[model samples]
Target: MESIVMLSGNVKYTITLDPSVWIFDDRRQDLHTYFHEQQEEKDTLEEYTKEVSKHWDREIIEGAVVPPTLKTEKKYLKEELLTGTFCIPFKPFLTNAEVSENAKNLVIETVDGMVTIPLTVAEKMVLGFSKDGKPLREDGPIHCYYGDGSNYENPIKNVVSFKIE
Candidate 1:
């Protein structure tokens, strides 16, 4: 299967996505745990500012203090990269593509056919690229999992590209 997919139509930018690189992306989430957790609403900008402030304070006061668990965390992350199932939520990519306000739906072009979904629903979707630390080479550049977890067991696979309409 091809490792790249494109986001095109009704957008400001045509994006070429390489799912293979997402394995190392910080935005990649653990697919198995994604659905089980309830997401809490928060002001991300505020949270980010607070974290930066804390880091700045520490840098000025303590001259940089590294957590003791840093090494352990790195080790665990390495292990996870070797064995974890992961996914990248599609919201960011769609946002970057700048979907046209007139666009009402997104058509997922697959190897065999296409599936159409509302733009709102498309924003909540997740692109699963890895399973058990392996790329989904048999039938996927990605598998799209619904935002509402309605199709977790059987996601939309064989996706080749997305056309906004």
Candidate 2:
């Protein structure tokens, strides 16, 4: 006698698992998450600065100087270049920084510590971060301005800037 296969009411579903699928990468995942978090933090900071900058003046710390200001004289205009503004942060030895012409974006290091000048979004993008994901710089023609903070100002040593004009 031939046995008949039962196809009664109950339907059983089988889910096949592929072990080869990428479940987790403790190292790479962590690194990626870290970078993402850093980018978010940077964005938050930039946003906060953009909002708060409308009110307060920008100042940098120097050796035993109480909130030093980096002012300049151009065309007989005694301007508080770094006051209440963002200075452009750049590599200490880059040549393009001279474009500002007022030393408005210039920052000096004192024996006591480092000082930073405020910079605008344009200045920050041009001075901070590389086209290929590297350290902060002050070269190349200015291009692009990121406001939402998906990226960050690559924290280069002794560097910071804020807008003036």
Candidate 3:
């Protein structure tokens, strides 16, 4: 019953048949810390995604919501695109915002002719509100004069006020 074995070229070897089966003992201690950090990052990203989703949903809801059967043709529907009563495509503008380098200012004429303001991020609430300082209808379009933030040539300059009609 020899405890050591000798093999070719005078090499000696020792073998532990049971090999401690606890290889993951050290890693298990830090598992919880790793998981906690991952959860924190995940939660932060989820909050960011939710905020982005809110704006995305608003654009989608504001755009044309026509039923599937009401379409005259197979045109691609865009949440960021608006269709006027004349079937004209009108793009929106964020207040004092320039979406792209080529975006220009635009005008919005409401059907009621009650309110007209610049379409901007800061003015969203103003347009969203009713004349009596009450809440405006969320489903309908709030008319305004918008600068599309494009057209570098003129860029809708010298335009300060907008008309309701």
Best by TM-score: 1
In terms of lDDT, the best-performing candidate is: 1
Would you give me the overall lDDT of model 2?
0.28
Compose the digit string of candidate 2's lDDT tens values, residues 17-114: 11112112111112122334433213657877887764344333233344323332342232321121121222221332233444343232322344
RMSD of each: 2.1, 27.8, 32.4
lDDT of 3 at 53: 94
**Local distance difference test, candidate 3:** 0.26
TM, every model? 0.88, 0.16, 0.18
Ranking by TM-score: 1, 3, 2
lDDT for each candidate structure:
0.92, 0.28, 0.26
lDDT of 1 by residue, 1-165 (tens): 688899999999999999999997878899999989985545879999999998899789877678677799999989999999999889989999999989999999999899999999999999999999999999897999998889999999999999999
As a whole number from 0 to 100, the lDDT of residue 121 in candidate 3 is 26
> What is the Å distance of residue 53 in model 3 from its true position?
29
Itemize residue pairs with steric clashes in candidate 1. none
